[model samples]
Target: METQNYIEYELVDSVSDRNIMTDSREEAIHAFEKGWTVYEHHNTINQHSKFTQSNLTVTMMWNDNPEFQGS
Candidate 1:
């Protein structure tokens, strides 16, 4: 059977413009708690190889607030 794998979430830090991909929701939430904005990535899953397994991708985005820069 042919299958597709895609990103599940997107996380980015506006303050540092840093980004990362995850497979679970917990990780995304953790990044958000740290001031990172998290987004859900909706896409098709890629096909898995006979010897390799498919994985999910989560993204997060976080922006530093100007008012909370000093704190």
Candidate 2:
């Protein structure tokens, strides 16, 4: 929906520019949440097959607000 939301350009009064972003833990948490939300089925899942260690786990890359890009 976010991708298509820009269709009505006039409705969007203004756009904001952001510089740098820093991610605390939301990146990892958002991925985990998306997987379980069947209603929103917009999903992201990661597998660490190369990491044979049992302790290894998949984590989503988080970028803090402003830039919305990976840190």
Candidate 3:
């Protein structure tokens, strides 16, 4: 049996709720630096690995208009 180990990065867009998967660490770091959420996953054949969130952002929205009733 042949075994392989690799790491994958998931770049997420919080606003759009979208995800992009890639094998390039550079690409993941770049996306994270640009405000994209990042997740890291490690994979090994026949073995369980760890999944981690590398970056996160919290967004808040406020409505100052009295006429605005959250519809």
Candidate 4:
């Protein structure tokens, strides 16, 4: 077996702590446009002969006005 890499987008309401995952940038943007904050998450899984390790990476893209708070 080989290492597997994965990437995903997250649309979050920072204040409310509500979030959803998306498969593409476009979907993330759309969610952000609808008053949700957007984030890009990258994941890497390394497989070894004995065990595996997984790492997560995240980046903030867009944030809506705090006043709105996912209205």
Candidate 5:
């Protein structure tokens, strides 16, 4: 028996509300650097130990919206 773990990253654009999912951390970080919101998903499973877990974390990265600027 062996333990297994899986991880995923989600990038969402604030203005367009579009999103992309990937397993590559580099890609996620690239998107985050470009002002996209990032979310991490982690899943762990161990049949031998009867253990399972899932977690989600959000990293909010946003740029100032020009439309929201005070006149």
Candidate 6:
């Protein structure tokens, strides 16, 4: 399955803790930890932005879901 299943929302301005949504009881936490590590290395904080800011930008293309057209 693709993680592109949902719209990649701009998490920059979001106020809520991402960990909450990511918490599938410790399992999800661990998954995210691994993913976050990759995410950090992949999107190093340049003189530009944070990991979530650069990497979490909305994907204009979705998984063929009409509901995510603007995503």
Alpha carbon lDDT at 29, candidate 4: 65
All candidates' TM-scores?
0.49, 0.17, 0.58, 0.48, 0.57, 0.19
- Per residue, candidate 2 scores C-alpha lDDT tens digits across 1-71 of 44421110001111232222223234333433433211111123211111112432323232223221323
Give the residue spans of candidate 4 off by over 4 A.
14-17, 45-71
Candidate 6 weakest ten by summed lDDT: 38-47
Model 5 error, position 53 (Å) = 26
Please report, in order, the local distance difference test score of every candidate based on alpha carbons.
0.50, 0.22, 0.57, 0.52, 0.55, 0.28
> TM-score of the candidate numbered 6?
0.19
Question: Global CA lDDT of candidate 6, please?
Answer: 0.28
Which is the better candidate, 5 or 6, if ranked by TM-score? 5
Error of 4 at 70 (Å): 17
Tens-digit per-residue lDDT, 1-71, candidate 4: 96667767657776788878777867766676666766554555221110012222232322333432335
lDDT of 6 by residue, 16-50 (tens): 42422221224433443445311111112211112
RMSD of each: 13.1, 16.5, 12.8, 12.8, 13.3, 14.2
**TM match of model 5 to true structure:** 0.57
Writing each residue's lDDT as its tens digit, candidate 1 over 1-71 gives: 75565545456688997877676778876776676766555455331111111232222222323332222
lDDT of 5 by residue, 1-71 (tens): 96568767667787998878788988877787787866565555211111112322322222223332212
Clashes of each: 24, 1, 0, 0, 0, 0
Who is ahead in TM-score, 2 or 6? 6
Q: Give the TM-score of candidate 4.
A: 0.48
